[model samples]
Target: MGKEFRCGYGKFEVKKMLKNYLLFGLVALFAGLSLRAYAADDKFYSAEQKIVELKEEFNLPSLSVAIGLNNRLAFARAVGYSDIEKDLEANTDTQYSVGSLSKPMTGLAVARLVATGKLDLRQPVSDYLERPQYTSKFSIAKLAAHTAGVPHDTPERDLAEFIDVKDHQRPMDAFYVFDKHPLLFEPGTGQHYSSNGYILLSAVIEEASSKGYVDYLSSEVWDRLGMKATELDTSFAGQESEATYYSSVNKEGLHVRSLDKRDRSFLFGGGGFISTPTDLVRMAQATYGVGYLSVEALQALSMPVKLRSGEINEEKYSLGWRVASVKLGKDDKSWLALHHGGVTDNAATAYLLVVPECKASIAFATNYVPGQFWRMRGRITSILKEYIDIQSCDRWSFAQSSVDA
Candidate 1:
């Protein structure tokens, strides 16, 4: 009556077809299991569970995480609150000031420019800055690696003065900090962690690309990687999502308050980026692409030098990354890791990037600082270790009494 619907096949034939379909699906399922047995390994999930408990104990308002294993991001999650006052939950979109984690991003830009034949690692910085009157002693490589022989700037108002002058119409206003100081060394002769040295490199990026540092990062690197939640701008100031940095009145004292957030113009290339933890994990993979630099110029980005000496100083500087060796297993050889941390009195930010033999990358970021660095380091180290091993155990202890509001 209904135009003989399904007249082409009898009921018996339809049942047989459906049975075959289910049989094929079951076969595919078993094949998938066998494939995973050889390729996939559970590495970081257990560690992540412990970390969640730790964050709750610490009373952290928010936390965002991204973990990579077996050459892919195995897990990512956002927990707690981004805005404690509003009871807003933290999510992968929550952006935190990445602080010194900005270094590797700058290095990537330099590498991309190099690939395009737009930058030369060995070229003297004077060539880009037109500071020929000064001796052409150091090269761009040293500057990127922090072995530029430059000492940290010495002035109480260095940051304050730079912040005050950044918004001016004149271009020279931002360079006032360097104009006030003298060279620390002849460049490439020694190594020291100098934020000022990095700020200078941003100037080089601008000169080479004819673009502002922020614009370059946004369009060239971050946007291209689809890192929508990450940004380098001054707009985050006084925003609800931004974490209030808390530092003790004195280094050892328990009293604390929010540190004043300065204009991004002051930090420039050295350390002025806001990102969620998920974006940062994406960044790590982009930097280490399938056993090769994504582009030819990026190859030079990994060129490292001894940045420090002695038993504790194991890291070498490679472009904008701090490269180190880590032990992951008993019979397994050590893996190369890039690490860095940022401190602005009130905020403590640390990043550990372990590129295992299997090409897995692991990264972590935390907002609160307990005022004791050694204790903080221990906790951070434990979290990383747990992720590497996939073990379940409480690594950080935040007080439940303090966490409940």
Candidate 2:
């Protein structure tokens, strides 16, 4: 259901709106709307209409979004072409590569292992394997928080090279990309975003569980959540439900050009996964609402980066998610936000936002990433907020430290 806004019935464009308008009046009636009084142009669009608008505006080949409220998937929808040239329309199950969002899965996997006493955040990761030459040692917690001083990439090796890895890069093999480089700082001394750090985390997970990264996750998380459509960003092509990846949608003369064939497994624990909006929401529920994380476990994942010098990292990053204070709706009050955004070398993008206060979570995904994904993100968020009626946050508290930290 959607909120009531002032709009003229005659001015509603049937072609642009999603679904048939056959029962628009009846639907409005149930939604507590009487469109008799307001002007035409002042009308607010529903989530469906706005999804179409965002797809068109950003030239997204395919887009999907889902909302989880009160521990259930309340809304899920997808639109546009999964393959523009093939004209394959995307459905709610279509999977798009959600880059860095893989971090939380890794984080949760670590938490699961910790719960079983198979992993320890405070221990040196070197306990699992021999420390690589030139790399300063760091604990698992620091690595997850990006405070391990791991460099993003080795010198003379741009991250794009790793991003475009076409070879079957195993999590351990991926270490060569940054293991030889020096740390950005001493471990636990500072914060720096590092995809390579996740590579290390994956290695630790592998050692602790004695299982493959995807295998461990499947058995522990996805299977438990019924997220059957989620999987690693493998090199194998032609998966039935995976959306076509596009590096660029159009050029001067060509219409749909520049496909991106990436084997993102090099960054497996950090940025290697394709998932649907529905699956992402499923993940949000398990990670935040379900009995999956104990109080202390959730505290570990949400704990803000506190440097060795005692200064809080301004990014407010935790093990796998970002912790922040967000002011929602039209109110001036602030709410706790646990969230992450994903971008895959301009090929795809995704974002998942959790408003704990409302027990509400929203996920957005697209196959083709534009230069302005946030603009599309903002528009879709506004539309979904109205659709789900998330106007305030009262069920708010950090699993870790207070906002004042």
The candidate scoring highest on TM-score is 2
Judge candidate 2 against the unseen true structure and give its global Cα lDDT, from 0 to 1: 0.70
Off by over 4 Å in 2: 1-24, 27-45, 133-136, 155-170, 249-255, 259-261, 387-405
Clashes of each: 2, 0
Q: How close is candidate 2 to the true structure, as a TM-score?
A: 0.84
Query: Candidate 1: how many backbone clashes?
Result: 2
lDDT of each: 0.57, 0.70
* lDDT tens digits, residue span 1-405, model 2: 111111111114435353444356557668877564221212233566666667666766677888887667777778766776676777898888888899877888888887778977777777886867533376777778888888885652344344445643457877777877777777767788988889888888888999987788999889987778888777673378888767764455223544453467667877878888888878877545437766556666656767777777757787688887666567786666778899987578999887665677789898777876777656655654653445434553545462111
Q: What are the TM-scores, per candidate, against the unseen true structure?
A: 0.73, 0.84
Give Cα distance to truth, residue 404, candidate 2, Å.
Answer: 14
| The 10-residue segment with the lowest total lDDT in model 1 | 396-405
